[model samples]
Target chain A: MIDHLPYGVFRTPGREPRCAARFGDHLIDLYAAESAGAVEAGGTLRARSLNDLMSAGPDVWSSVRRQLLNRPPLDHLVPLSEVELLLPFEVADYVDFYSSEHHAGNVGQIFRPGQPPLLPNWKQLPIGYHGRAGTVVVSGTPVVRPGGLLGAGVVGPSQRLDIEAEIGFVVGIDSTLGRPVPIEEFHRAVFGVVVVNDWSARDIQAFEYQPLGPFLGKSFATSVSAWVTPLEALASAWTPAPPQDPPVVPHLNDDPHHGLDLRLTVTWNGVEVSHPPFASMYWTPAQQLAHMTSNGATLRTGDLFASGTVSGPQRGEVGSFLELTWGGTEPVELGAESRTFLLDGDTVVISATAPGADGGTIRLGEVSGTVLPAVI
Target chain B: MIDHLPYGVFRTPGREPRCAARFGDHLIDLYAAESAGAVEAGGTLRARSLNDLMSAGPDVWSSVRRQLLNRPPLDHLVPLSEVELLLPFEVADYVDFYSSEHHAGNVGQIFRPGQPPLLPNWKQLPIGYHGRAGTVVVSGTPVVRPGGLLGAGVVGPSQRLDIEAEIGFVVGIDSTLGRPVPIEEFHRAVFGVVVVNDWSARDIQAFEYQPLGPFLGKSFATSVSAWVTPLEALASAWTPAPPQDPPVVPHLNDDPHHGLDLRLTVTWNGVEVSHPPFASMYWTPAQQLAHMTSNGATLRTGDLFASGTVSGPQRGEVGSFLELTWGGTEPVELGAESRTFLLDGDTVVISATAPGADGGTIRLGEVSGTVLPAVI
Candidate 1:
């Protein structure tokens, strides 16, 4: 786990899907990775990128992630200086889970007051909502806010567009149909983790989020750091979760040591606000994986399963401005900055890193994006 | 609309992702679907055929989908001969939704018994799960039945893969960030619809479905009709839904006529067992669109959002064999067929057609596949 390689795609500018990762200064060609037996068992990186081979499901992927993590510095392989990171592999589906109990209760109290725990099924299984994959973009990319009708009637235009900084897990080596991945086996199947900022628009959401939930407020554009930090590398940081208030349904839960020791924090314009730890969640990622598979749906590589807004109980600890502002009521004060939601000039940074035993953070970089005027 | 040109990416022999669909005669070269116009649209149809585009969403393609639908003659787009069909777009993300109240209530009653109705959220949004987009084979493709362990532990190896014939929608534009898609604008952003047979293995599901939903049992394989009918062509047949039981939330719903008027039905072997209609849905597609957007999630073209299994209350009128078998306690009776679930070598067909004034069906053709034994 010593070598630092940056994963990305290259296309001679405009060409078919080509896989490459960054070494100290150049792209570590995945095509060569396949050919050299350094990646896939069968040479030729054809299914698209490392992701295609990943969707073949865990065992195969685990082996690769493990091998790559322990490989020594390939001083002669390549350098990062010669590469340009294209928009990472197109994400087919994004399923973000509300596994953060701290967030659930914190958000619940604000909205339901007395009911700050969770739904009966919340602790029992991984409750997830499928999100837009189209908006997922590579880092260093600017976010363009979209303009949509606000309120029921089309009167004027959209005003509030905010940002949500969080972390996401990418699935590699997907499971075959009907074969539910055992919680323990789930670990072996993971490809990597990346920092994801689920940018939002609180104003558009306020008017329309009742009967359905969230629409137009989210789908416009999303940004993600391109590097995929394999789960194997983050393994040393694994931690168990605190006991839940009520026992989960027997079918959906597992052992307590299921939580990953990942540190997630959010910053708006470089100001730290939400610093909730991943262990604060009642449900674990394994449990979430188990719950998601309960319905016979297949999980694939390039599948973006996010840990929904990691908010805490504190006001500034809110995951998104919508929660911090309490549905546009409370204005969040940031040093000299004050706002109920995100202003166009604001930049949100979502960084996820696992603190190694040496006390150094193994950061997966960060996904930062600035809001531009709405694209009409 | 005019010339009916159905597209796909397929060869005459290979069955990997290159198999072709069968149209009137000569295969419409997938290479040809690579339009000069699509390149201008900032998208390409470089798929080996429609197989990749149909399944490889996120890069929703400009092949002949819109051109075929807008042509008018509806029949002149056929190539020479009567036995050739190329490939369809590779569909990357396959999502199936449970939009039917009748189906939900009926399925729920099995576990809850006298439960009054389905969940309130069901009526509000289009709840969905991600499916295996990688295995979306072209029409006339053979399907391998998945086998798995039963509940508790392994009783023995069993062959109980079942079939769930569903109607699915394809997205045209994809969103990022947590942007919510507006309900009223859902159609404009949709590419088309295809009849899908969401294959399932209930037996394996029972054993493996716990913390998570079904994984291996259902991830095996799926079948879809060869040709895709564009969304615009179906607009004329669109119809309003019946009165709501628990009125919908404002933002989540739309005009009464938003639901499509497709006459969807499923057949096992040669027997017509279900006679349900699309209008029987408790929630409209608009609500599903709105709910999906509520979380500020974006959608992309080639992204499939399916209406989960549709079923009515009657004994034999259920959409899926799962309900008819009642957790495998009852055997479903078809004309000459009596079955609990699917069997190896068994064939299942899902056919959908819009009802014309003369009552004939404006068909999107059917998706039929035969189950083969698992390789082991």
Candidate 2:
């Protein structure tokens, strides 16, 4: 059986938040176990949030996970359905990177038809931009469609609402303010991965994203999986990445095992439509972390950086509606439903699985959200 | 005389941080004063940071200022030179807005010639993007030049480092997740103002700021004035904003006094270079705040959003080196030293003054940074 003890924050009806570890379909209450002298990891498990455990560093992270795995099920064991999950960590800064070549090529072709597919700097560096950290929510939170200045000078509800399915990496260690974290040491700085649904308002983004980057269009709400799959648990999923086309700089170059071989799936209204393969991504997480710190930007414990839409080569591998529908030129048919973009009352879910040590699959959980009408 | 009590965090050699306020040229230790029963406004002043005071709302903010103003000289008063100033508040989210018409026009002209001076959506919304909050430092911090992928397929030290002098506003009260804060209620949400130095790597920005916005080019460092001048203290500085060509929506359109009439000045080393007038900005701070939450994005207590480079429609009113040197076509003569962009060991300072109650100028202090050589 796969031994993936992903971490999360959960709570009962009116109880304080507690650190939890998932085993099969049940959750181990770390707080109650620690108090009962059954586990002796640290007091960090007693914290109301996962950020404290994240700040305890990788050594503690490993010890805690191992201890949680070896312990027998006590009376503290709770069913997953009985608890409510919250966002795993407090985000210090949220950054989204455009790393998938297939997604970038499709976006570039749709936006600029006659010109080159990717921008000149796309291949040279890991292109990213900061996003609203406070707006990030846990899975199951209802997202209200944003209302802003759309095209045709209309100030009303977003006409082109969409979702971007991607993988998000969270930082568990802080880096020095003026030093760069090399690609090899990315694991020391990063903690784990989660599924992220980067909600977007295409019309608002198109009209306002000129000189600056996307703001309100993507800031209203961004949903992330409540569970954080620790890096150590996913060791078996390590695989060789594709070779760099032009050869990246020395700082971005790393060992081939730095790449992850996860399979990501996006479902709309409970129907699977996209199966973007994480193995097809050109840039690895190690390279993304190295490029992020290359300019001496300090990394805090709760910082999050997401891999941009993970689209593969096939038609059903597109991650976002903009690419899946080819800029609304085509409509994606989901059995009895046909959609160009998302509509009110529509639900989107994203999940992923990685190779397990026993030749099985380690589920990374899912981040799901339903779109509500704009509160205008 | 104008008695402005700006708040900051400070500490002696071997002591914990304490809250303090500046009056004239001396800083009063509010923590010590509160302990000594010298001033009685609220318990928020006893904290180590200004965040607690900011969350205390406008009434508490006014009372604390008034109490500090009327108090007699305390024995805990320290000279400004002897105190170590830290960042006034913990930044939850940092956003920089392009609100100045002249700066936007000059940048547009230099970047895209034979096109309109401003983008089509310029006047429609306050264009802004999230920035790295973890890299934001206090005034006296030394900023290191960043190394990254530049043009010509070269990845090395940045050749064109620059600064954008701007005014920054800090949010005190939080807005609901899916609710918009009306323009008239902006004061209830915003706490204070401070001077900000948005450092830039022009070459890096030019190369990577395409499909996404600025990343490594601007994430290395951002410096801010240590002391935060409360908005209630600058009551008399309110002035009428420029009329909109096509009137804005009801949510953004507000009373005339929503404008701030501050005069911003920039200096290189010790020589005067530019003076950017805040009165000429097209959008007001209230309107910016309203637009930011228009899409139902939540606001946290320590959120900071800065006014973009405050350039006016004149030669000497440019705020950034890019415009002052006309995209490096012209060189700025700082007395005996001539430069196109910021050089290593060069110090840039930005300070401002606003209209006081007694018809005199009230000092807003300064935000200064010395550029260190690239650590490549």
Candidate 3:
């Protein structure tokens, strides 16, 4: 897709939803290519989300990516199997984080076996929480299977049912409440990248994650990626992250190329399983937006955040099914049966890619789902 | 004032913010009392926030509270010092909870000193999380003093800055994402009450709350309360709650009159100190909205939640200065100025009240703020 044009919110049969972009499988219609002038952007592409062209910030997002690569609207295409998409922005505060030190040492050695797998402020920073931006959603929706309690006075539904994978970002411009969005203003305060999922419920997050964290075992839904992708289509997907031996705090210092190298994969039910690299993420999406606004926390324009699972230290690189089934006491297999968590119809699907500025690759927008059985 | 009419979002002078209502000191302008036909609500109070009159729910919130107690628009008054208010709704996902068993046994005995101060799922349920809905704000706003990493390779500011006097609620009907909102549908899904604060930091939430919980030690600034109040102005403030020794389960049981009573009053700068009560809350805002939608999480219309630190077992009934300075090893005087946290231009406020089917009280709108220092 000519280095992934991304952006989303579609529609078709009886119009309305607007935005668009994509390209190869066709979609364009950025308000019908700016009403046929073939794209200029001032009228924020007749919005229906993408937070009005991501709050029209990074110089009108690089002048609408150089007028959609110099006018390639082809009379506002459409096809992508007759539209639909949606949820392409309107999250406004989600957070997530846990920046994967091998998925926090495989969820702290499968939930603290002998304690100390990572938590000492996990190499000093990016820990993060706050989710449930009204149960996120859009990316083949479905999901369900939640129900809670699960321990002393146990409740039901959710017999495990996991899947994390993450990545998210989004949050275009808007800051100051007591400012703090620094680390070189993360591409002038981010504006793209998606593929999330995050659904969990591991026994209602192991009996309600102690001391206040994962609520309702991960607020019931999550999913995401109905396109987006933008950070100028991953400018050759940065890279460097994975180092910080003991260095983090100067307001979460940064720039070791500020990682991105994507790669992910996941897929269950269709089998592929895990690949999860994102350049082995050890805290980077500009140090989780400079430690989520260091403490003056105020970002807004459809806020989001994510990047919490994306594992990577080998053995098929884990991005969760409780570290690819180890916490389900190891399961895996799949193609001919054999799983662990997540079952009622199970689908999954994550996806990713990156390295693009022409040397080809670029994908991102995937995030499927499926489950659907609880509502009990 | 005739049972606190509440609802806010003002403006005036050059005008724009819209929606209003208060009354005692004046400010009716609900779209100029729906253009002088003096209130019907179909156009949802000429909007500017209270989320289209809280998604026009609860039977148009009891037919606009019986057409504003039989049309008392008084020609859309206005005075409340010529308007301004703002931030009345548009939050959509905040949460918070930890249903005060004396503020989670005084924050689990000042952060687990010898462990177990209550946390066996804190007597079974109602603990919560998800905050930072774009740093909440709007009750006098200021706040600041945030800064982070306060430990290992330490960062600065926030020596202990705290506060938390709780009780929020809001939401307003919108649920079904795999259902669950049970506990007798908490008045058809809430729709009122405010007065929060919730700002904290305690050395950046004790060196970044161990394993994922309080981010940026309570996402810099959470104020709330430019009014709202109306759960039919707490019809004689409910009462019963505080008993569950160990029952709770069945979708969080519910209805020991479902608490409320209210009271509150913290203050600080003009020193009152603490009162806290809220009928000694022990989980009940209909069991924290049935344990926050018992995992089927959905509810939208500006979703809020809150009710965490409403401590109360004795002495000054704490709602945090980390348990009236117990964590900073006791201080609290204020007039002869002793204190123990939150300094820079200090301020605070909080306020509350309740019991009023007519027999007096009502209130709830307070929530002030101030603090402001660290942008470092």
Number of the predicted model whose TM-score against the real structure is largest: 2
Clashing pairs in 2: none
Which lDDT value does model 2 have at A199?
Answer: 96
Better candidate number, 2 or 3, judged by DockQ: 2
| Residue A374 lDDT, candidate 2, scale 0-100 | 88
Candidate 3 residue A305 Cα shift, in angstroms, is 8.1
What are the per-residue Cα lDDT tens digits for candidate 3 across A1-376?
7657888888878878998888887778888778777788888888788797788799998888877886677787878998789898888888888888888887888888897788777888778888888889888989889878788986789788888888988888788888787898888889888989888888887777777777888888898889988888888889788678887667678755468888988888788888888888888888788788877788979898888888888858888888878889988898888878887888989888888875888777888989878877
**Model 2 alpha-carbon miss at residue B90, Å:** 0.2
- Give TM per candidate: 0.69, 0.98, 0.36
Candidate 2 residue lDDT tens string, A54-140 = 999989988877776676546678999999998889999999989999999999999999999998888888899999999999999
Question: Number of backbone collisions per candidate, in order?
Answer: 110, 0, 0
Q: After superposition, how far is residue B68 of candidate 3 from its true place, in Å?
A: 13
Give the interface-residue alpha carbon RMSD of model 1: 7.6
Question: What residue runs in model 2 are displaced by over 4 Å at the alpha carbon?
Answer: A72-75, B72-75
DockQ of each: 0.15, 0.77, 0.29
Order of all candidates by lDDT, from best down to worst?
A: 2, 3, 1
DockQ rank order = 2, 3, 1
| Predictions in order: lDDT | 0.60, 0.88, 0.83
The candidate that wins on DockQ is 2
Candidate 1 — number of clashing residue pairs? 110
